[model samples]
Target: MDHQIQRGTVVLATPWGVAAIFSGVGSQYAGMATRLHQRYAIVRETFTEASDVLGFDVAELCTEPSARERLNLQTESQLALLTTSVAMHRAFERQTAGPAVTHAAGHSLGEYSALCVAGALPFAAALRLVRHRGEAIADVAARLDGGMMWVIGLDTGTVEHLCRLWTEQDVHPVHLSIVDAPRRAAVSGRTADLHSAAGEFEARGAQVFPLRVTGPFHSPLMGPAADQLADFLTGIDLAPPRLPVISGVDARPHPGGPAGARLLADQLVSPVRWHAVQQRLAAEGVGASLEMGPGRVLTFLSAGTRGHPRPWPVDRYEDFDALARAMRLGADDEPAVLDACLRIAVSTPTRRQDTDVAGHYRRLEETRRARKPGAVATGLGALDALLAAKGISARERRGHLAAATGGRTWQ
Candidate 1:
């Protein structure tokens, strides 16, 4: 399936459902959420709430260039990404009535964002949890001189073999941390060990680049951090997700509550199976995937992969309209007119005396029952007339209609 936005509209070659993918660490920028914070009250409110929980101003950390160094720190970056991603999701829900994603997943620290979006964790609680997680990992990194590196142009088997070989020969342990693509993977270990193995990796026709991370995450060396995180998680309340969230630890739907908590803690010391996660989403028939935060990292990873879902980045203010349209159109195989009517009804504010919600739904059902060729057009026209009668402006109606029809204008 291919999703394209042309002339303020979304065009879909094949209608498939959307999967929401959250951004992880290293995706943060200095002003990633500045526009969002300025435009939406919900976004500002989210930041304020996060500040209350985090003891620092999240908005300032994300927007000021002076805070660049601080934002790059593991704890600060994780908190900023989580807060910004959740704010974006909240704003999206407000604009589109609700998210239209069939499933949700996150990379590395992003799993917390996915769980929050799935309603498994409250926003305040999520903030506190990630803080402790970041602090624990940072403490581990402070004591151990370790780091991670990305290796390209090498298959997974060869990379695994090389890691095993280096660990045995050099007495320095290095492990394959992430398998992002077929020939792209990341390794985690002590800084000296990674530097020592770089020549060997290059000798085997692989390109190596060190990652800007504080610690060698997703390796056995992180076992202490994982243990600390596990203890912290036991005190927090976790609810079952309203939507399925694929875990990076195993690329399977997370079983919420205690089991889900275990997977999250273990994730610190376990390799991220992103390749398997993508495959699982493809197998589930996801048509489009939306990156819900600032960077294009996940978008780039999903690109050019056969049988993978088409990836789109909702990283800017202008991306909301097209994203809403694409999600609305791809939500199901229902008639376009029905979607338009339903969206219009949901987006409109209700009066204090308006208590005929059931009647409104009955009317929607009646419209759905009319399946004739011209009936759809007639129903759409009637809906327009009703909106106009209720004092809806021409511009607002056009926007609503475009959202409903994936940017197609009615004649």
Candidate 2:
């Protein structure tokens, strides 16, 4: 007879997907997904009266790699976002001390998940609420010509001042979106405004670029969506949270119950106070920070400033055991902040003393002329930065014209 042991180290020469599934952040996601699916089957069955109307295949969409593709559809995206976050919150709570949570918050769609975890709304109710929100908000973004832009190397006050100045001078208003870092802010509005702002920032030596979202989110343009969402939520039952959760709208702890529901609905139109959320979390002495789903975007955005100027730590399932072990050692003994900083710092690009500024700009001109959007924009921006560092003016770059759109220049 053979004896089996789990939760113990087993050495292997090769890294497998199973290992990813069992380790750190990956394991949390897997556990959350599983927990949600089980509840989804039971809950969805109750609400879905007809097979044709409720035709979404949860097991297939969630389990398949192509699930994210389905999320591109507004309805599906909302559902998946809600389900994944809520499930993760539930799973995480069970694993950690339930009373250890002093404050809770989420970024954008993740806010609903936070509320669910905090007990302001039930998981099923939150899912249904977000579905309606996704549909309403997506419809508005499609109609608007506005979008978002990332502004790096500028203070938030400076960015806001520039936006006001730009709008006053006939350039559309730069809707300051989220303050992700000390020098990083996301601005939203018309595409023309964004392009103009990007050009201005580049002229002033800041790295500005577009994000891959379809519509202008977190601006006044989302007001209609907020209204509709509010109407929908008005009919739903809400309860006081088991714990306090911070609001991205104002960065204050929500009062829970009906107030929480209203804030969740209003979040569609409000700017996310991600910077404030991070500050609050740190002030509360939260030693470990975990991004509940998908990309490391949230983790990067929420990292502490008191540390060596890097981003947040990540505890994906692969590091779950380590995180668990660390948490057991208590907050004062936690390694999350240091771990997060190490992860980001090690990945930062190292600048060489002999790097070429002019030649780099020339290459960017060629790439932009070739019409690969991301490569063109990012490449050109980096080229511009290098050139500026070498004291090269934008106008003096002869091939800069090559980077211009053919009779359809960006700015």
Candidate 3:
């Protein structure tokens, strides 16, 4: 089937909902997301929110020449990529008025972005978590001598066998880190060991290419970083996702709360099962895949998958319109009505220290009992009225709404 977009429409597409795929590190570049930032108010607001948490101008870092080089560093790169990916997703939602994401996934560091999109983590909390994660990984990389390489034209089984042989014989550790496609994988180990093994992979009819990364991520060598991240995550709160988020670590839906925290922390030392992630998406009945970040790396990976759910990259301004038309998303649709429980939840403050906690809960329960399970109003306009009547300030409205509604305001 033809996967390419022709005249802003996708051909041979399925009827199931879309899967949003967030880009990870190594996808960031100078001036990435500048177009979205310049054109969309939501994008600018996202960057501003990230800056408040990160204590740096993320927009400037992505666009400025001098600051762009900092993206090469793990800490800066991770934060920048997370901010940009989140911003792009928000912009896509507002601009396209598309169907709510049915599922979400990310590659490596992009998992944090996927969690944010799925409403498992608050935006500010995600930024702070990524900052600490980047720092922890950077610290580990500084202490260890490691690298990663891509091995194409070889199945994962063959690559795993080769890695096992090398690890059994060599002093340095070598492990399979990521399986991107059926026959494409990445291996990680000491820098010298990677270079030494490159010849063997090439000799076996596989093309070996070095990746631009600081450390051998997604391997046991990153145990210290995983520990550091686990400690940091314990203090943060995680909520259940509105939509399913496939984990790169295990290619399974994240079990939210403490279990999710453990999975995320352990992911640092776990191989990214991206091939399985794609399979999971297909099994979930995702009709199409949208890359909501700077580069088309995830798009390319999805394209390589056999059958169903064609991939599209929605990084540029025009991409949103193209994909919206192709998928016929939100076309001629009436405004979505909010449920009573969700309206009350949005109006309620998440902070435990808020005044009249018992009163809020009692009112929420009363509203839930009084109203049926669906359709509180013609649209979110009713929710806006409720928020205003409840005296929820404009500044807190977006965060409350996003948290309560899983960032899909249209839903």
lDDT against the true structure, per candidate, is 0.77, 0.55, 0.73
lDDT of 3 at 230: 96
**lDDT of candidate 1 over 287-401, digit per residue (tens):** 5677888888898897777656667778743647665554443324347657667777666754333335545455565777765433344445545555555556554544444
Candidate 3 residue 307 Cα shift, in angstroms, is: 3.3
Let me know the TM-score candidate 1 reaches against the reference structure.
0.75
Predicted model with the maximum TM-score:
1
TM-score to true structure, per model: 0.75, 0.64, 0.74
Q: Could you give candidate 3's per-residue lDDT for residues 5-71 as a string of tens digits?
A: 4565332222245788987854545655766777789989998998888888988888777886787
Backbone clashes, candidate 2 = 14
- What TM-score quantifies how close candidate 3 is to the native fold? 0.74
Model 1: per-residue Cα lDDT at residue 12: 36
Candidate 1, residue 23: CA error in Å?
1.4
- lDDT, ranked from best to worst: 1, 3, 2
After superposing candidate 1 on the true structure, give the runs of residues whose Cα lies further than 4 Å from its correct spot. 1-15, 26-31, 97-99, 168-172, 316-319, 325-411
Maximum-lDDT candidate: 1
